[model samples]
Target: MAEATAHSIDQDDFTHVVKGIRYPPVVTEANLEAMLNFDIRDDDIVIAAYPKSGTNWMLEIVTKILSAGGRTDASSDDMVGKLEFQYPDEPRPHHVMLQECASPRVILTHLTPDTAPPGIAHPQNNVKVIVVMRNPKDTAVSYFHFLEKIKFQTGQKRFPSWDEFFQLFMSGKYNFGCYFDHILGWWQRRDDPHFLFLKYENMKQDLPKAVKTVAAFLQVKLDDASIETIAHACTFSSMKASLDNSRYRGRAVNARKGIVGDWKTMFTDEQSRLLDSKCKTKLEGTGLQFNFE
Candidate 1:
């Protein structure tokens, strides 16, 4: 195996590759090792999404639905849940911290299926998984803007220009690896009863219906009134306001615009065609399709 590269956000920010997959510097070799052995409980609900794909929005909706509008302490961070970073005041890694949490934990991760907890990979584990995916074009555009935001905050160019980012993203050289690989890894397991596949576009189209689907998947019953309330609270504006006042103290949630086809404004015609052709080839015969608009 290649040596893991160490990077600091205060210094130069760079990604490292482990087992041929790229990840942020926070996701160290030790963390990846622990993640493989991480134990998942029966009632745990794991929300898996590629970065820039409505992860926090789904997290809010699911937690609210699970708590029946009551307060929930379920923590949702892409890296923390995957043991990529240790939380403050928490002595152990996140995977270890999860073991001490109460039952029916709402776990969030951006890890691919193979790298996620082994328990969720099996069909009979009783762990419910909610995988959220977005069209690659929009995802790429959003992710590029997100990186730029990070660069601005860190006062350093953490990533390349849009033209260079497009090439790196297409080659799967960016953090968390390729978008297509992550989507397909979980997409192949969509038939498992405990697994539920969601599209960000679909959720934006009718959030109340999406809430109902998630509730049903978790076996949590909710009336139309409750669904509407959760949907309203999960809207982009509402959630952004809540996050703005949140004590979590992480970087921005990067939900800018939150609309589909934003890629049209950013991507050149050839770039669009390139992504379209790549998606067409990767997703062919999988019966999975995405709506650009």
Candidate 2:
């Protein structure tokens, strides 16, 4: 297990982590205006989730659905091209790319409530938003491993242990902004006709059902056979293997450990308790709970 440091750090240092990859402490009025003014069609769909919360998995599922039983003859690379990130400068740009694509766009984003594009929050907008969530313990563990690999590949020597990483995560000092604020914002709006909430563990436990649920939300029709094919194709093992040897090649780090509950091996009892306490406090009355144990 990783140990937390007793060494004290200032708020500025902590806030720096939250701003990582996002750059610019604030999104700025100009940026928000640009995003809100952008054209959004009625047929568009957005996949919104926190970092390391199965956003890619949901992207794969939506791509497969749009492909009509995964027989569109497009490679995973082609599918990746279709499912783009909305936040370009941020850690994940899939959501931005999706916005630029043609009709029936499936964009992914990690923006918190405050940072969510103005187009998404507009009542007149017809696009559907699907939000996915994972247990914070698991999300923290996965995020730490992801950052470690990033540090290694980028030649950065400073890597925090799992416990240290958890503290930062709890403090709302990770990329894509605060986790509590992000999920809670979406959770509160989950009852909207255009919003759907999906859990990572539930998707991993039964992907076909999850895929079908998403398809239904998008009003996309998929036959039983097509559903099975997508379910099989989106499995963590299949995606990991496919991504491992794709044209993108050597860029598939952290894609292999896409299983649910992997955090069990990475978090200690104390760390789990700390995370659970934070979750309980932040998530209260939201009707959103996690199976950390």
Candidate 3:
């Protein structure tokens, strides 16, 4: 593998990729203004993360923690279906879903800080927000596989090659803007009373404690037994199996192999060094850390 050249990043409005799933469009100042003016429920629970950063995993854990016995009734299928980020034209509007759901509605977004719905993530807002952090190297690797497993337009089955994808990823032109910038925006608010930050690697190291931490932030009281039930149900294997057998089978191809450090094999020495430099510079003095092991 060779060190790749930097590529131009595209900032298109709401592009569609991988089976009609829509990535939110470029967040112009006007767009952010609109979101700020929008109405949001006070009891809203927002989950934010870059793509392939254990978003779905966190969703399952948070959902199970809230629902006794680690499960909710079938009536919640509409709410459950709306948990992942959808295209701008998704049949149901995110705001509408929030309005329709019962109090303490849970919604997810892959948007950056500035672009976040104003009522949801404002510095003064006390809305509960869970932001999952992960090593961008691993995230990039997982996201690449996701793009491939998701059929592309023009009838192509796979995406641009790994080297090509890596360059585009480094340029911050791929999905959720620059990965570093997105995290930094949220990191600034870690001290906010309503925000909770969890590391992906730390969760892998100790799932029980991780689940408990999430529960505490959400103020969901669970005894030792309930915590254990949720931890078991949210295990990567259990969640993946559940998705496979459910209505989300093909739609969830990108949710496979919830492991860390795939970048070790996937990244060329040059690419690894480049990512390390970028991560180090962006994360310096921010006190955020990731375990690539």
Tell me, by TM-score, which candidate is best.
1
| Candidate lDDT values, in order | 0.77, 0.66, 0.69
Work out the TM-score per prediction.
Answer: 0.88, 0.80, 0.83
Clash counts for the predictions, in order: 0, 9, 0
Error of 2 at 215 (Å): 1.1
Ten contiguous residues minimizing lDDT sum, candidate 3: 13-22
lDDT of 2 at 46: 77
Give every collision pair in model 3.
none
Candidate 2: which stretches are off by over 4 Å? 1-36, 69-76, 79-100, 123-125, 246-251
Q: Count clashing pairs, candidate 3.
A: 0
Native-to-model Cα distance after best TM-score fit, residue 184 in candidate 3, in Å? 0.5
Rank by lDDT (best first): 1, 3, 2
Q: Summarize candidate 1's per-residue lDDT along 192-263 as a digit string, tens digits.
A: 888999999999899899999999988887889999998898888877866565544342545578898899
Candidate of highest lDDT: 1
For candidate 3, write residues 1-293 as lDDT tens digits: 11222452332323433221224332233333456565666666678888888777787787777786333442222353433333334565445445566755667777776767766567345478889988999999998888676544223533468898898778765656678888888988888888899989999889999999988887777899988888988888777766655554233574577888788878999999999999889888999988998
lDDT of 2 at 156: 53
Candidate 1: residue 121 Cα off by (Å): 2.1
